[model samples]
Target: MKAARGSVVSKKGVPWGTIISVVAVVALAAVVVTYYLVQSAPKRALASWAPTADNPDPSLNIPGIVTGQYQASVHILPTERVAYDHSPPYGGPHDGYWAACNGVVYPVAVRTENMVHSLEHGAVWIAYNPDQVSGDALNTLKSKVEGKPYTMMSPYPGLDSAVSLQSWGHQLKVGSATDERIDQFITALRTNQNTYPEVGASCDALGAGAFDPDNPPPFDPTPPGPDAKPMDYQGSAGTQQDTGMPSSAPTS
Candidate 1:
């Protein structure tokens, strides 16, 4: 069993936790929103990494879901000269992902400061489709390459969003992969059947995360409830910063 997030949460604003609701988790098409909570921890704050606001590569069509605004823009980034500054991947036993771009193979999922820094942590891979992306957007993206390399990441609205992911872990809200591996991953976290070691993905699953479980809940893999609302949220970046995009590497 993983240690409770509260135990690691620092008195400072840096919290390694903020129990995520089932809706948000499903919405993100991820193992759980526990990732946010984990980053809140002080020890975990500078743990990952953030990149230079610039890089020079445009082939990868990216999108920055400006949470403050409902709009998304196209951006670009150069990945060849990457670096890791802080901690490595958080969750234990998480799978590593891989992808192929123009006949090139790259590790899509692996926990590291470089992953988060490049905003390449959760990039998705979309089978190249020209119509999915307009010509104007593509040309504009290329033009912005060197001056603001990472700027091309944010694709304009209506590009099916997940159009570019040459580098990160792509967070999905809903659709397609839901019934597949996503559901299974959530199920494991819901019940004690699985554990994250660092992040707590509880849904009162183990009796509200056990204040201090001298004797924790039994290991049961069933989900709490189909439509469970973990809790209310006050902050939601209306637009997804890194989402529903395709990528060359597997998302961890």
Candidate 2:
């Protein structure tokens, strides 16, 4: 309507600023939701692959998996060593004390005897050849082991493969760190009640001397001497009683 001269006019228009802010918030929310779903997808898939009576060891389904039938409760003195059948033994007679496998990543290659003990406790030992794996490849493997219970990783000085995963009697070697089978092996075996011997066994380090994760016994690269114990050798006397207990000396 016609109004008096110099009168102001009131206008109603779209709130562009408010509309832009709202759109931005919605877009951000969508991105966050997508990221969450993507990150969780692998874990969700792995959950379905848990060990079942009908399918006891799901890892057997994975290609290239090697299974063994090693006797349990066989222990060795800290001073002794095993002439393991495999380069990185999956299972066999081992030291009385166990390596700290509660998501530990040993900076140096740990003593084989102690690490095998961890496998008896359902820990998945991820061994990688330091010469073959490094940079992003090594980091990828670390992501899977770090902060995950019943899991550990170390540098295998003379490993034949880029990566080798060991869990009790199971072993899988892969040419790369990003192999899908790595995760599959871990999900199927680590702490799997149907597979490992010492169910509910602790992965924590026994203590300072027996098996210290911080200053663990170094890996012995030399060939197991003529005196090295055989795979079938029965444990030393009283060694079985020392399982899970700390010793006065560091395990080597």
Candidate 3:
């Protein structure tokens, strides 16, 4: 059989077929060579002077900006990941916001505004904020709605059983940030929350013993307005996120 013009030889005298086989072999060789080149290429390393475990931020670089709407560059995921997805805390990852605030490292949760910054370097955790019923107990409520009708998806339009709690925590809280800002340019994203035993929201003791000692609770931490850019800090992993307590109310 006459092979195509590019073919110079044939396997068992099958000329055109030999041309196809030769092309296939060449393609495979190219792929192998490309793979090796990629594997052998010099890696791009961070600056030699870059921070290390011993001195994390030598020049004081701000790291891990998670909650301003951009997805976390780093995240706290379940230790054991499944086949294709992360096994996040709570019934699902979304629950952490309404109920998952506890999963957030206390320092991160308190940052409330600069969430991503915390997720970047600090330890991540999960815990649920148990809802309390105050004011009135109405009867006509069939199943009693059982605890705040709590679902991760509440307070948002997009999610189904999947909701972004960390998103809500930032969005709903006073002086919170808008989701679009962080999310706009992000390429990858995930939200995380864990649970912890219930802690008292308020205390009666005054002075150093009070543990906040305010009513309806000074428990909520609202971030400074989006425009209130965060300042840099030089401290331990935990202190990096410290905006301190949100002033019970920011002074005008």
Candidate 4:
């Protein structure tokens, strides 16, 4: 039907394809932004809580954190153990050989004495009660320690809490692996110059005969015998070289 000279042509349906494409792009952009925020939020929070002269021990601000005044440079032999005042002790006399705490996660319970030495070297030890933590809960704790220097995690049988974090003279026990205080404790104490005894100590194992991370010494759950080393017992002079002490004076 040939109409008059100029008939108006009307365009009917909406541009559905174009609209859908725009919506998809917008959704993808939103997801990317959300992920960035989620990943960086914790780091930002930790930076704010970093230790400063005014806040010498920022871990003190963390709720339920237990602080102690254990003397440094105290080391015991591998065959000896200390009658630690606290369960999964935060500090005190420790084994002469420090555990391999450079982001190592032990599948079995490690000797507390060796682990405590790692703490003195400014490493944060994450001890979880195997009976209480497993599966996702266990993995969640591992995520905080694995591949993160100055950090290590191990199963501690008979642990009073589901999770316990130890760094030098500090300790924090939480009921679950998802506790926010876990990161806070790590941020404040791991390698904090004022808190730990050794400032720039190495978290690596000495070697095969020393503290082997793969086949480390088994944790003895038995109560420390009467002959166990006392808290005030000064360490042997032979092991002092491994304390990471600078040629100058040592810090508390």
Compute each candidate's TM-score over C-alphas. Answer: 0.18, 0.83, 0.20, 0.82
Best by lDDT: 2
Compared with the true structure, what per-residue lDDT tens digits does model 4 show for residues 88-187?
A: 8998988778999989999999999999989888999999999999999999998998899999999999999999999998899999999989989988
What local distance difference test score does each model get? 0.25, 0.89, 0.24, 0.86
For 121-193, candidate 3 gives per-residue lDDT tens digits of 2212221221321123112111112231121111222122221233211221111122222221111112212
Q: Can you write out model 1's per-residue Cα lDDT over 1-252, one digit (the tens) per residue?
A: 245665556435633354456556677865445676666663343222222234222111222311111111221122111121111211111111111111111112222212222233222222112344446644433332323312212222222432333223222222222123222222211112111121221111112221112232122222325332111211122211233243443222
TM-score of 4: 0.82
lDDT for position 7 in model 1: 56
Candidate 3, residue 66: Cα displacement in angstroms equals 14
The candidates, ranked best first by lDDT, are 2, 4, 1, 3
RMSD of each: 29.2, 5.0, 18.5, 4.4
For model 1, state the Cα shift of residue 216 in Å.
44
> Which RMSD does model 4 reach against the true structure?
4.4
lDDT (0-100) at residue 113 of candidate 3? 23
> Where's the lowest-lDDT run of ten residues in candidate 1?
65-74
Clashing pairs in 4: none
Worst 10 residues of 3 by lDDT: 88-97
